[model samples]
Target: MATVRLLTMLPLWWSLCVSSALTPVRLRTLPLWWSLYISNALTPQALLAEWQAARIKSLDVDASRYHAQVLFVDDDNARARMAESCADALAHWADAGWWIYPHSCSLTEDQALIENPRQEAILTSLGFDGTRVTAAGAALAKEDLDAYDLVICADAAVRDAVLALGEESYETSVRLLADFATVADARSRALFDGLDVALAERARSRQDGGELVVEGADAQSDRDGFDALLESTLVLTAALVVFLKDSFDASFTDSFNGLLRTHFYDERHVDARWADAEPALRRHIVTGALDPRERERLFDAHMTGLRQRLSGDGVSS
Candidate 1:
């Protein structure tokens, strides 16, 4: 009887071993659980393997990303499509990211990519899992510009427009984006249009305020700033997607090395080129302020904080 019982247990052990290998699991967590079972053998090892796999899978689905919002300033329907494609490809991931495309970011109403079935399907396939899809652009209440680490522009037209908007107009644009939050009507398209109008007005203000002032030689600077803001914004926004997908776990930092590069800050791009000439452009950002001196001081404080951080990173002074 004793010999027969021992022999039967051999099959039970073999079954457990096979099950552990067959189940889908993360590469890292598998070993620890496998070892526990291999050593303890008190409970089923396969169950432990399954649990670890589930935990890791959850990380991919949720992570807190910063500045995942992207503002794509486009000009026409074709441009919107192109921008959407690029935004989808860049933003679509395990953790959904945003590419806030405002129709008014373009030149006219028809310029927006409002309806595209195939593109939507493609984005869906990529897991564009964003919870909200607002047609209105982001309304950042209060110039609260410092809250965002990056701002991306799809075109030079966008930068010119942003600079053109007056302070009140810019504030209204952000409000319009907020309006989308409450839009529960069939006329979502119309509500979205209202938001576009706000953005268009803001762009016009940026230009009229002399914020977008330029000459023959400095024309490239405007383009550079626009591009830089976009790339930096994409990177920042994508980082947020990555972070949120991982549920804000600091250990999920494996993605940074692949993207943290100089191409984003290089003058070959719009951001880099514009940053190189910030002294001249700085005035434009504070154009509507009551006290330019105080604003400049505040801006300086912000710059100091950024510069100190950059210096610590071994970046060139």
Candidate 2:
């Protein structure tokens, strides 16, 4: 009877072992869990073998993915029409499969309250949903500038106005609309062609070690600085997806740990790291007016906090 009872429990134990191996942990949470698995397992190699076996038993989806942010800037009724049409073209590209978040803004404050009815009519005729385009006369908020991955200016004046807001850093990729002209002023097709090349290049940049950082903010008088920070944090979440997707094929925890080790845990990549911790950075920066030096300090503090958490336990249980 005792031998039979012991034999009966063996199958149950085997079943549980197999079940644990079959479930693939998401790359985002894999690091902490992998560490804990190592601690409890008979050996690291043994756990790896089990994980490999589990992977063979089922398909595991890679969770690393990123979306691009694109912003269109223009001024005056004529430019607004151009911007709206351009936005519609970008939207079609987005629907086709490019991961993108696109927005349009006016360079002049006075234009923010105006609406572009003509542009709406054109967009509707193109089989585009006019409502998808924000009213033509809206201005780019100072704080919101950091949210864009690409800025398409309708003209030189609009580009200058955007750069005047301290976003000169983005000048590297900011493009002019006139660069691509058609015989019949085929604006939409030309804009789409220019954007296709531009967006493709931008996507390649992520793989080539493009630093993910918020470019700059606008100084809106009525905006609460803290609220602006919070909004900025949200904008970077999509940016983070691009970073993580490109950085690791699978297992964010392992990849991040490897990065920490190689970089010697220094704050060399504060911009990239802080971009990851924008929520906390926003909270820190909002405590006072945003000074240039304040960003470095807040990033350092945030890094310290992250190190503390990692020290106590894995990033996830």
Which 10-residue window in model 1 sums to the lowest lDDT? Answer: 1-10
lDDT of 1: 0.33
Clashes of each: 29, 2
Model 2 C-alpha lDDT per residue in residues 59-126, reported as the tens digit of each score:
22232333445566766533434444444444454241244445566776686656645445534554
Each model's lDDT: 0.33, 0.42
TM-score for each candidate, following the candidate numbering: 0.24, 0.35
Off by over 4 Å in 1: 1-69, 77-110, 130-149, 166-317
**Poorly placed runs, candidate 2 (over 4 Å):** 1-65, 77-81, 84-98, 133-136, 179-317
In the range 1-317, model 1's lDDT, one tens digit per residue, is 00001112234675566556445563245587775554454244334334323332432221233223333344433223333333443344322333222122343455454443443443344333222222332332223322322233333344344445434233222211111111212222221222224432443333233122111111133444433222222232333233333333332232221122312333233223324434544444222221445434434544454455666776644
